[model samples]
Target: MRSLDSAREVCERFHPGLVKALGELTFAEREAPGSPVIDLFREHGGVGLLVPTEHGGHGADPVQAVRVMRAIGSMSPSLAAAATMHHFTAATLYALAPTEGRLTGAQIDVLKSVVPDRKIMASGWAEGRTEQNILMPAVTAVAAPGGYTLSGTKKPCSLSKSMDYLTASIAVPGPTGEPELAMAIIPADSPGISVHPFWGNDVLAAAESDEVRLENVFVPEDLIIRTTEEDPERMEALQLAGFVWFELLISSGYAGAAAALVEKVLQRRRGSATDQIQLVVKVESAFAVLEGAARAVLDGVDGEEAVAAALVARFAAQQAIAESTATALELLGGLDFITSSDSARLASGVRPLAFHPPSRASVAEALIAYCAGDALVLA
Candidate 1:
């Protein structure tokens, strides 16, 4: 509980009253559709948690970000899950710094409102959980007068209901007149933007992971961010940076849910001394792995190396969640299961981490090859 408490303190420091606000709501209320968690998140300035100080954000470092994510995760898994999408999308804004000359004026204008207006961003990239490759573009861009028209669907898109902007991955025309991967920032209220039900589970229903369909959605040219011909690797690097944040923050959220169950077990002293110690060891060790990866990024690690670190943390946290939660439920036994639904809800909230993008199965081979002195290429 010391680590969780400390992590929560960090969250409190960054976004005052956020944890308390989330705590005020019942788990059932927070997990239900039409949940007020997103509203609370916006009011608490959580939409800008990852934005930099120059951009009117908290400017939390990698360590602080993960800590806040864990604290938030402990309270509302759905909020943490949905917030991960928004936070990671905001994290990309750092790479698009004005000095980098990578952002268009229109893109900068929309991003400028993110922190001040508490606008939520939904990720349209990383749709590869259903596709064969995780990095494939999600939409097709047809050249139009001003910019382009896009048509596609991102299923299970988090923050679908409340998002103010959608950061989409699309295949734009290249110099060879072929499809090249690029990112487009589309306004949520665009002519062809719509949302429909897709998420059927109640585990993290508050996340609003549903289908976001775009049909002939017109986007201005200035809102599109593309890789320079001089540096063709720019787009891949951008995606990799996003992947690192995604892996660390999302995994921490699930870890927080599992930690909540562990806290319950520790409080009631239901398990034996040895059992409690093992629970702490397993959970803490998993968190240490996650934090270690975060620290690595802070220590100037980037590119494939940073992504590899994040994946290690994510997979390690996944295994720990599986083992620790099962142990917790067993110690809780039949009575707790019947008496309180919070324990089950908290435990179930963490199970979906295994299903996020860049899954263990998809990247195992690439990681192995990278360890053998090969470039890490995620297919």
Candidate 2:
């Protein structure tokens, strides 16, 4: 695992006061129903961790971003998960924008305001769906004079209740009247936008993973992102970037949760020396894989290669985290399992890592085919 100093440094560099504030909150307070931890995070610029520095926020590189996420996960996995949505939303906007040409004034203004206003952007992308449908929009957008009226529901939208803005994927009519994927950025309070309780479980209630419904929600033309069918390469690149960002950050968050479990076992000295050594090795190995993957992303490797590396790294980390957390639970014994809420919660929290995009079961065939010299195609 990363050194504590290194994790602290990442947090200090990107969000100076955030670590201290999170440390001050008890686990109960952080996970309580409608926890105020999100508000506290916003107060310390946590929402702007991935926004560019020139835009008045931290422009952390991929490695730094993952490190900060791990730190947050150790303290509060719910906060880490919610913040991942915010950071990734910012990252997607920047990644999808043209590199050299001038951006529309409205788009530029929205990006700039994210940090200054402490805006929390929720991801309204489809989730809990199969990997084949991951990027496909469940919502449809009807063409209008100035913009499109969108109607769809994104279930388990993180930060649904607290977000100030939302970035969603909508199916728009293409030139041939065929459904094509398009992204829309709109205010959370837009007319006809509503959030309903859909998470239906307490596992990550603090994340506010509710359902966001859009009914004839008009998204201005300026806020739309769409690529022509002729530009397959650009669309591929955009999707690859999203996958890299999502897998890396989500893995880091769960790694932190697993790390917390290890810490508790060590603090209590309940496990034997050999057990401690074994668990430490597994946790460290997972972090090492994750760090390597993050470095590949920051180094700007070929898009397809980077995506492949992220998938491999994420799966390896997932296995290690599962083993480490289960081991830690056994080492902590039944008494601690029954008496300690943090221990039980951390155990449950680590399970979500397996549920993130590009599930191993869904991509196993493609991954094997790629290893045997076939083209990599996730969908």
Candidate 3:
């Protein structure tokens, strides 16, 4: 019932407590079996930012979603990852569903009844379209009596074990070589759906990434949201808009995490010196960039401005997380090298950021686009 700002305020108010809980629980098992963080999510109604009001969501804007996520990320990246999957799925639904919305009268009733009781939702995408990539499974949709059956495997689905809904991307074959991309929303217990565990129990231990296999999973047509190919100009605009919010959610969260790491370095350094003050300065500068970038995201200066801002935030946050984590190791001296402390975990996490989407190369392109006149008019 509250406004978007108010919803954000509530999340902000709970930030310190939730973050403290996260810090205490960090060394626990990666997924930790029964995570209190998951409980927190359920209690807060599963980060209601993406859910529509009609569907029991708070209906907050994407910017507010970014703020909420950043606050959560500062405390726990794993939990932040888990929470983001839900919003990402929700956003996908928003984009794909009809103008009247995807959830039907019956479906909305079921969702409202079930979502409050469910803490998570998983999303599956990334098919191995090209050969030599064992992961990308071809998308196939066969006509069934009641509806269509979806078949394929989507990789890197976060929160697979705990989520209630699995939204997957399938390449429904049509006349064209490139099958139409459609989002299929399947319940966690749907028949013929199999989830294969993927990512190792290392940095992503707490957050399980799985490969979702749909073997003739029957889904009513009403549930499918077909992706429409639009004019190049319009598609570009939509793509940019999509990136703006998604990037804000991701970049801001990483910024908060970086800030936390910096704080930890300071805390440990002042008490007992190992790493030099210059190390602190190095990380602090990264933090400064993140802060500046966050402000830019908040300000909504321009399309190009927003893209550049988000890119800067991404670069700064990753740098800060990497360096501060390294400093944590040096500050701890021999402890980090042993692979037993948070430093080891963070070191592993930083390594993957190199491969994470919106890579540095992409960020560079965004910057170049802004530098050129291309920034004018998202279209």
Highest TM-score, which number? 1
Instruction: Write the residue-wise lDDT of candidate 1 on 166-192 in tens digits.
Output: 998888888898778898999999999
For candidate 1, give the lDDT of residue 330.
Answer: 90
Q: Whole-model lDDT, candidate 1?
A: 0.88
Model 3 gets an lDDT of 0.57
> Residue 183 lDDT in model 2?
77
Candidate 1 vs 3: which has more lDDT = 1
Better of 1 and 2 by TM-score: 1
TM-scores of the models, in the order given: 0.97, 0.94, 0.73
Minimum summed lDDT over a 10-residue window in model 1 is located at 126-135
- Runs in model 2 lying further than 4 Å from the true structure: 96-102, 130-132, 175-178, 228-232
The alpha-carbon lDDT assigned to residue 108 of candidate 3 equals 50
Error of 1 at 231 (Å): 3.8
How many residue pairs of model 1 clash at the backbone? Answer: 0
Model 3, 306-379: lDDT tens digits are 66676666676677667766665666567545755565554455444444565665346546666775653221
Query: If the candidates were sorted by their lDDT against the true structure, best first, what order would they fall in?
Result: 1, 2, 3
* Distance from true location, Cα of 97 in model 2, Å: 4.7
